[model samples]
Target: MGRIPGRLPFFLETFAQSSIKSHGSRIHPERFNSTSNKVPDMKAHQTREVIFSGIQPTGVPHIGNYVGALQNWIRLQELKKEGKKEMDLYYSIVGLHAITLPRDPLQLKKERFEMMCVLLAIGLDPAHCCLFNQDQVPAHSEMAWILNCIAPVGRLNRMTTWKSQIASSKNSNSLSEVDDSMLHLGLLAYPVLQSADILLYKSTQVPVGEDQIQHLELTKVLAKALNKQTKNKNLFPLPQGIYTRQSKILNLRNPTMKMSKSNPSDLTKILITDTPEEIRKKIKSAVTDSIESIRYDPENRPGISNLIDIYQSISGQELEQVQRRFQDKSVVDLKSELIELLIEHFRPFNAEFSRLVNSREDVEKIYLAGSQKAAAVANLTLSQVKKHIGLD
Candidate 1:
């Protein structure tokens, strides 16, 4: 149950190897993707599904990240398992984006590794998904610079994430008091880097939360702009966003804001690895009104509604069902049920998470291998892009 962050212990390595074997097969790029599409019964020109998505290195992912995004990634892979077309997936610890704000070098390194453990612990089959640290691959930078040239400054100015930064937002990073004057070029232009991350692999589908829709829209726009100049019109797929949830999970402390790691109050977000006592404490202290009745009303009762949303998302119950189940009960009853539900929901992964985090070197090896796989695709895309743009 202990998490030792520095190095891998022998038993943890043995356990990881055995546990990962059942998760999935290694990502063979030539098998699922690669430049070639030749197969036993398939035409050479048939399109394969290339999925790309990422998360910032927030150490242990919050429950919002799980229900909103991570679970969807796993579910998508499972659904693709039943499909006829081969699929390739790329999930990244987007260190580049993480640095749009300031970060300590030492803490950033630890957080990056911790995020990797969270991904694996949550049942992302390494075999089916190429998990890499985006900062390791040089091509992402190169591609970002390329995309930056064509990306409109006006569009970047309009991004909501950037606007939040301008407003001195605490939800994303309230740790520092910041203003627009304090913002750097990288913070303003990082969405272009995001575009490069998606276009670099010609990602066919992108899994994202509600907050990322605008960023993904910018990706599509930039793709179309580049395609206009290229003789090869279909160089990029104009990646589609696969939204899995109706709404994002809001902060437990403040329902008006989205759940984020940077929120000053630790109670605002529930981490996947939080202990049962922590879970109970956070939920019991969750911000709700004294209406004495539960209803699915976001406008008047965001706190209770957010809790209901959590119950619905975790239990796979309809919103109506959750409301009805909790209607006759007190808010205490609802909090008690949610605490147990969350504890049970994450119990299966707790040991594995601790073990994976303990096996630090083994974790490094997996992502290093993934980075190599990611580089192969990045190199190919960059080559074609260079050929078109006269950079070759």
Candidate 2:
């Protein structure tokens, strides 16, 4: 989740502008003979880091979600505030991508608003970063279509997420049990769109969970592919992945599975806006071992390890530190302490979320302003892409 602090050279807009023109079709593709244009030599020329991340507008994000991803975002924002790292951060409510899965129209609308609210409630500064809705920006879909033309279908077939979904639905682990007929085009080509999301902003870094590393890899592959195809190395930055330590947070009820909004059981995860009482009840009912000892054994005792993980995440302590603190403690006592920690952390956050939920108009303005900021960057990238491909 943490990156070693260092400065990257700031991207010069003029450099990119001129670089694109130099390789344009007007000069004749044959004349674009340069060692730098070679795929292997396409190193990151731009120093200005663009960090892009998105969350689906599916349901309320759980505590696991916050600790694993959102918390890291806050750290990045703080780092930005300190002027330790110069970067452009873009966060989005990926409403367009959400529709790849089935959704009720009305609920989708509500979830988008709520998701934005949660972003603000979690302390993402609109002034410091571009926070917006993906559907509000046309460039995402436009760029996705353009990228899909060059993206290999065979590579898309190898994508793990879509196949895993099909596997889960059919109750099989083998991908051989599934085929193209089982997946929609949107689902099949979702990685192409995800690549567009990152490339649209020229994102140099993407904050993602381990499950999403493949998607980011696809983004890099597409970037390299495009550079090779267009003979323009500066066209897009191949985004690097920021992998966090606690990226895959387990479910409370079933430690074997991820803490998912789709889990059907509310007790499986703790929402940010959950009341103190609700938090207490949920943690109290959290599935723990009958052995009744507080230890950090994940393989044999996933549930206890999960609770320990949550406790350590919220407390900002190491597992050894947490274990030492609760060495001889019972599960009931552990759950009680976790309840208190969560309530203390989320009290103010819940207030902000409630306030934003009430002031829907203000939330809309924040989203609009963010969308405009994102669109500005996206427009420039898309325009250059179009120009290079002779679409303009």
Candidate 3:
């Protein structure tokens, strides 16, 4: 069973100060309100753009994951390198969230390390941005326990992820078949935990796909709820969702569904580490109509359209441009070109990924260092939250 709900841990008091000073916590200094003894409006006053996002550690991510989110993360880092000096990025391998459902113990450890490697290989520089495992920081769960007190069950029930998960777990598509007695508390309330993850970092910008926008909305709601209890009403920044055109990538085997690891058939998705031969085989097997032509018609020709989407997302070309370029090419031609593109792109990155994964000692140290950076900022926020919630 999980730890008792609603009680913030006492360990944070001992840990917060050291972490803050060591990790470069940049919380803006605020003048105290002499009359009310409360912080001033911080909503309009955050000094830095705290950007946060996370990925589940399921091993090497597929091509869809890269195109959908990881690619955008690199873009964000590059933009910051170009001198967005005030922006800070935090990317976590959400191990804790991944285990909400059952997982093999040994595989979890392996996947956690591999996921970290994937981030590094994809150009998420730990020297600049914070990269760590969510489970490494105690304060995330501590803050989550605090958030749970005010989060509404109705809101959680409304979350489509939660709804679908509960349904799938019971092997039933109907809501009536879902038995409340068997409801997993962690699975149901993980969104609240996610809110804690965002608010802990004072994240003002969150990179999210279309499916996750509602979860971010729930974060804003919980932040508002907490701020309402304080005189300032600005303890947390309402983070906005960042979306990319390539956020929703469909499967190769079935164009109707998003490319996901949960799909039993390996042909449905292409992993970043797959060999040239494997990439070629999967692309060739990708479902398409007998039109013998390529177009971006997602409505009637989802199969060919899905391939076009993948090409445009990877090549950074507009839909019209991609269509024009492929207007005369056959389906076989498109598949061949996409296969070569993927193979050439992943060759160097895959080497780096393998090296990082194999060098367990170095990777562990890097992971710990990133965790410390994240913890320093998180613990500082928890310190203030303690004062507001009477944990002090």
Candidate 4:
């Protein structure tokens, strides 16, 4: 994670106040209404750029997670730092999404807290951004049901994620393996819920990686389908994807695959909280070719390229810049420098993690406050959806 440059005190205070008001029980429902509200109209234009994105809180985030998503989030915060009220941003800890896969309850709870702490430590000013867990907002699931009613079953069947998950399963020996009957409703309808997540906030721009482009397209499809069904115009604004070209940071031991928490090998991913010694060992043992001369050819030299990408992402330098700096350098030299950079980057985050992990009460309060804030906005959207669909 890069340093947050400088602290903008005025913007931070304003953000905190907004979060307080938005999360407070005293805010009138009419305040969010478009007709008479003095607050800047969040929905006046067809292309409102309110941003929303999330990550499953199954485990601590690695360098790849930070570069791929969280870094973009922090940059959005910097835009808010200018006191521009035009954009409403949100970043969530999707605990509900994490449960799609089986997990230990206690460990999951702890991981969620740690993930929140990491986000905060990484300069996600909650005051500037809506930071909360997905389950905290009941309307996410509520609107999901409403959208599910309007969504075509045929569309759900066509989702690539659902098909990919089923295809990858090892239990394909039985007839039930290929059947939709065995697919859980949550798994099948997760994309609908994802659409709900975006529409609930009326988000107009979603910062998404390559993996989620299909899901975002589905969200737009569902939004349009619902509007047509209800005979209402502009019911949900189709969100544009803010695609980032950040290099894909690959696993240390396996240069071909991404660094992920779910990998069976612990050495495959570098957790932000990994000690200095752990980082050094991982990088030192990172798979690299016997070839000399460090270069950025991802296909011909994936191992060294992965390291270079990691270095460039963290340092905010270009691939060419990194290559020039490390030109004529040995693989050992590249690995050694990467270890130092990573250790320094994670130092503050690790400190913040320790503090939050120790203070369970404070973490709980933040989540509780965030949930209330998120649910307030969510409920308003759900109410409109229900009334439009005759569920009221």
TM-score of each: 0.85, 0.86, 0.85, 0.84
Model 1 residue runs over 4 Å out of place are 1-46, 165-179
Model 4 lDDT per residue over 126-201, tens place: 5556778998888888888888877888878876676555543432223334666657878888888888899988
Better of 2 and 4 by TM-score: 2
- Predicted structure 4: lDDT: 0.73
**Which tens-of-lDDT digit does each residue in 1-392 have in candidate 1?**
01222333222222211222233233222333342221112122126767788888856788887776777666655554546336777889999988887788899999999998887777675566778889999999999999889989988877767656544344443423545676789988988998899988888878755557788889999999889878667888888766553356889988977787776688998998899889989999999997887777888889988998888777767577887898899888998899998888777677678887888777777788788878878887898899999999
Best by lDDT: 2
> Residue 299, candidate 4: how far off, in angstroms?
1.0
TM-score attained by model 1: 0.85
lDDT of 3 at 178: 59
Stretches > 4 Å off in candidate 3: 1-46, 166-182
Give candidate 3's TM-score: 0.85
lDDT of 3 by residue, 1-392 (tens): 11222322232112211111112122111211121122223443268788899999876798888877787677676566667445777899988888877779999998888888778777666655778889999999999999999999998877778655655444444566655565688988989999989998899888776668789889999988888886657788788776554536678887877777666678988998898899999999999998997877887998898888887777776678888988998999999999987787777777667677677777776778778778877888899999988897
Steric clashes per prediction:
1, 3, 0, 0
- Model 1 scores worst on lDDT over the 10 consecutive residues at 37-46
The Cα local distance difference test for each model comes to: 0.75, 0.76, 0.75, 0.73
Task: Record all residue pairs in model 1 with backbone atoms less than 3 Å apart, i.e. clashing.
Answer: 25-127
lDDT of 2: 0.76
TM-score, candidate number 2: 0.86
Cα distance off (Å), candidate 1, residue 45: 9.7
Better of 1 and 4 by TM-score: 1
